[model samples]
Target chain A: MKVALVQDTPRLGDVATNLEKTVELLEEAAHRGADLALLPELFLTGYRLGDLVPEVALRLDRPGPEIERLAAVSRRIPFAVGLVEESSHHLYYNVAAWFEGGELRHVHRKCYLPTYGMFREGMDFARGDRIRTFPTPFGRAGLLICEDAWHPSAATLLALEGATLVFVLSASPLRGLGVGRHNLSIDTWVQLLTTLARFHGFPVCYVNRTGFEDGLGFGGGSFATDAAGNLLASARDIDPELLLVDVPVDRTRDMRFAYPLLRDERPELVHRELGRILGRTEETP
Target chain B: MSAPVPLPMDAPELTRQLEAFLHEEITKAGFSRAVVGVSGGLDSAVVLLLAARALGPENVLALRMPHRDSSPESLAHADLVIEKAGCPAETLEVTAPVEAAREVLGIEDPLRRGNLAARVRMIFLYDRAMARRALVVGTSNKTELLLGYSTRWGDGAYDLDPVGDLYKCQVRQLGEHLGVPREVLGKPPSADLWPGQTDEAELGFTYDDADRLLWLVVDRRVPPAEAIEQLGLERDLGRTILERMRRTQFKRALPLVCKVQARTIGIDFRYPRDWGL
Candidate 1:
C-alpha cells in the first residue's frame, strides 16, 4: 500500500486555517496516488496551544462541518489526522481519527499523556484506557499517539490483538545535539520504532511534525519501517515534507512466520513479572 | 597537557542559524523589538549583536547597567559594542537600589551584594522593557545555566534567551564572527559584583576546559568515568561539574508541586506557554 506522511507545521490556535491547510495537503497526497496519508499529532489545532486548547478543541464523535468536509475528501482516499477531542462529557483528549470511504472508521485517544520535563499532557487531556486494532481495506491496523509508542505495552497490546501495521503520530521537539553529528532525539525515535517493528514483525509508520512553536522547534524526521525493521523512507529534518513510500503488505506475515517471537510469547510470565514490579499483591496501609 | 577540545561548528553558519532562530522567535511571539542587558562580556555582547541584526538596530534596545564597584573597563567595552552594533543604548547605574536593599537587609557579604545588584539590574531592564513594549532578551549562556552561576530571579529572569543553549566557549566564537569589539571579546569574563572578580577565578576552571567536558559528558552522553578518562580530565573536575549540575537542577525547573489532585497546576494541569497567549 502506498502511504504518505505529511510533516507540516500548524499555526498555533488557528484551527480554521490549520484544517484548511490539512485538507489541501490531503488532496495533494491523494493526487500523488497515496492510498493512505498520516499527519502529525495535533495537526488540526497544532501542538503547544496551552490554554487555547479548550477554545479550539473539536467534538469528534459529533464532528462539526470542518471535519465533515474532511470526511467528504476521504471518499477518494483514507487518512488519519490528530486533534484535541472534546468528548460528550466535556473531557478533553488528544485523539487520532481515521476516516475512509466518507465515514469515520476508528478513533484512538492518546493513551499515555507525558507530564514530565517540557510536556504537560497528563494535566491537559484525559488518558485513553484501551488499545485495539481495526480492519482497513489493506489490513488490520492500530494507532498510537506520540507518547503512547514510547511504552512497550502499547504496541504489545495492539500486536496481540492482531494488528499488522501500526501508525505512530508525534509532534516531538528537537533537543540535545546527538553523538557525533547526529540529532539525539531523532536517533532515539529511530531506535524505538525499529525495535518495535523488528520485535513485533509489524510495519510501523511514524510521522512527526516540523516547525517552531513558541520557543520549541519540532524536528520532522517522519519515516516508515517494514516488518523486518528495514527503513523504507524518511522525510527531512526541520522542514515541512510529504514522505511517500510503498509498504510491503505481505512482509508482516512472512516475518512473523520466520521469526515466531510472537508465537513464543509468554503473557502469563509478563503478567507475573509486572505484578512483582508493581507490587500489586502488597497490602496498602 | 590534554588534547585540545574540538572547535565548535562553523562560526558563520552557527551565527546565521542563531540569528534566523532569534528573528523567527521574536516576530512569531508578536514582538518586533528586543531589550538586552549588555554586560560588556562575550555572552551579552553576542546576544546584543544578534538581536540588533535579527530585529534591526532600530528595534534593539541596549541597556548598560553597572553597580558602584563595577570595573570602568566594563562600561567602556559595552560602549564599544553599542557603537559597533548601532543599537539604541542607555546607561543605568544600579548603586542606589542595591545599596538601599543592602542597608535595609543588613547584608555585607559580597555574594549577597552581587545578587542584589543583579536583581536590581533586572528590575531596571524589565521596567524599561515595559516602557518600550519590548521583551527582555536574556544573556545567560549554557555554562552559567548548567552551573547555576546566575542569580535566580535576577539575571536569570528573562522573556527569552537567545544564547542559553550555547556554551560559553561557543558564545565567544559567535561573538568573534559577529564582529563584536575585540576590547569586549578579549576581556577577562567577570560578573563585576566586586572590584576584581573574574569568572574563571571564581569558578576555578576555564570555559574552554568546562565546555569540552560538558560536550562529552552531556551532549555526547559519555559516562562520567569514561569522559574523565578519555578527556584526561581531573576526576575532581568532572565530579565537581556534575555535582554542580545536580545541585542547580532545581533552578532549571519550575517549583515542585505536591500532586494531591488529578490535575495540579504545573504538574498535571500543564499547557504550553503560548497555549492561549
Candidate 2:
C-alpha cells in the first residue's frame, strides 16, 4: 500500500484555511500516486487551539460543508485525518476519521488524553473508551492519536483484533536532547513505533506536524516502518513535507509467520496477571 | 577514568536559531517590535543584540532602568550597547516608584528592596511595551531559570524570551561573538540590586561551575551521586542546585488550579496563549 504522511503547520483556530491546505496537500499526495494519505493530529483546527477548540469543533456524523468537501476528496484517494469531534450529545472528542468513497468509514476517538506539562487534552475533550480495528481498502488498520500510542496495551489490542497496520497521528513537541545527542522526543517515538512494528509483525505509519504554536514548537519528523521494523521513509523536522512510502502488505503475514510470536498467544495469562494487579478475583475457566 | 567532557555550544548557530525564533515569536504574537531591558550584564546585552538583529534596531527599544543603588558601570555599559547596536534607548531612574512602594510597605530589608526594584523596572518595561506596541523580550538565561534565581513576576514576566534556553556561560560566549563590549563581558556578573553585590557571591558559586554542574544534572540527567563522583561536583553544591530546582519548579509553571469543575483554566481549559489573539 502506498501512503503519504503530511507534516505541515496549521494556523490555530482557522479551520477554513487549514482544510483548504489539507485538500491541497491531499491533491499533491494523490499526484504522487498515494493509495492513502495521513494528516497529523488536529490538522483541521490545529493542536494548540486551546479555548477556541469547542467553537471550531466539527461534527463528523453531521459534518459541515468544509468537512463534506474533504469527504469528497477522499473518494479519489482514501485518507485519514484528525480533528476535534463534537458529538450530537454535545461531548467533544479528539478523533481521527478514515474516509473512503466520499463516506466516513471509521472514526477512532483518542482514548488517552495527555494532561501533563504542556498538554491539557483531558480537560478539553472526553476520553474514548473503545479500541477497535476497521477494514481499509489495503488491509485492516487501527488508528491511535498522539498520547494513545504511548500505551503498549493500545497497540496490543489493535494487533489482537487482526489489524495488519496501525496509524499514529501526533502533535508531539521538540524537547530535551536525547542520550546520543539526538532529538529526544523523536528518538523515543522511533523506538516505540519500531518496537510495535516488530512485536506485532505489522507496519506502522506515524504522522506529526511542524511549526510553532505560541512558545511550543512541534517537531515534524513523520515516518513509516515495515513489518520487519525497518524505517522506510521519514519527513524533515521543522518543515512542511509530504512523505510517501510504499508499504508491502505481504510483509505482515510473512513476518508473523517467521516470528510466530502472535501464534504463541497468552491472553488468559495476561488477564489473570491484570486481575492480580487490579486486586480482583478472576472467574477461573 | 576519563574526565567528563563539557557540553559543546555553537555560538553562531545558536545565535542564528534564536534570532529566527524571536523574530517568528514576536511577529506571530501580533507585534512587529520588541522592548528589552538593557542591563550592563551579559544576559541583557545578548538579548538586546538578538532583539535588534531580529526586528532591526529601528524596531527594538532598549530601556536602561536603574535604581539609586545601581552601579554606575551598568549605565555606562548599557550606553555602550545602545551606541554600538544603534537601537533607540532611554534611561529611567526607578528610584521614585521603588521608593514609593518601599515607603508604603516600610520595607528596609535588602532582599525585599531588590525584589521591588526588579519589579519596578518590569513595570517601566511593560509600560514602554504597551506605549510602543511591542512585546517585552526576556533576558533570563537557562542557568538562572533552572536555578530559580530570578525574581518571579519581576524579571521573569515576558512576552517572549530569546536567551532563556542558553546557559549563562553560553550567553557570555554568544555575547562575545555578538561583539558586546569587552568591559561588560569582563565585569563580574551582578544583578546590581545593592552595592557590591555579585551573582556568584550571592549564589555561592561561579556561573561556569553552576553551568557545568547543571548541564550534567539537568540536561544529562545524571544521578546526583554519579554527578558528584564523575563530574567532580561537590555533593552539597549538587544537592543545593537540585533542591533549588525542586523548590522553584512551581515558579516555572502556571499557578496550581484546583480541578473542581469540568474545565478549569490552567488545568483542563488550557490553550496556547496565542490562540485566536
Model 2: runs farther than 4 Å from truth?
A48-53, A177-182, A257-260, A263-285, B1-21, B49-124, B146-148, B151-154, B165-187, B194-196, B208-271
Candidate 1 local lDDT, B146-254, one digit each (tens):
8889999999999888788888887887788899888887888898879999998999887777787887877778898887777788989878887888899989987
* Per-residue C-alpha lDDT of model 2 across residues B83-128, encoded as one tens digit per residue: 8788999889999999999999999999999999999989999999
Prediction-by-prediction clash tally:
3, 1
Instruction: For candidate 1, give the lDDT of residue B39.
Output: 82
Candidate 1 deviant stretches above 4 angstroms: A11-14, A31-33, A48-56, A178-183, A211-214, A246-285, B1-21, B49-133, B142-154, B165-186, B200-271
Give the lDDT of residue A20 in candidate 1: 95
lDDT tens digits, residue span A6-93, model 2: 8998878888888899999999999999999999999998887767778889987677897799889988889898888999998999
lDDT digits (tens) for residues A160-255 of candidate 1: 889999999999987643232134567788889999999999999999997677777787889999999988888876668998999998999899
Q: Per-residue lDDT for B154 in model 1?
A: 93
In CAPRI terms, where does candidate 1 land?
acceptable
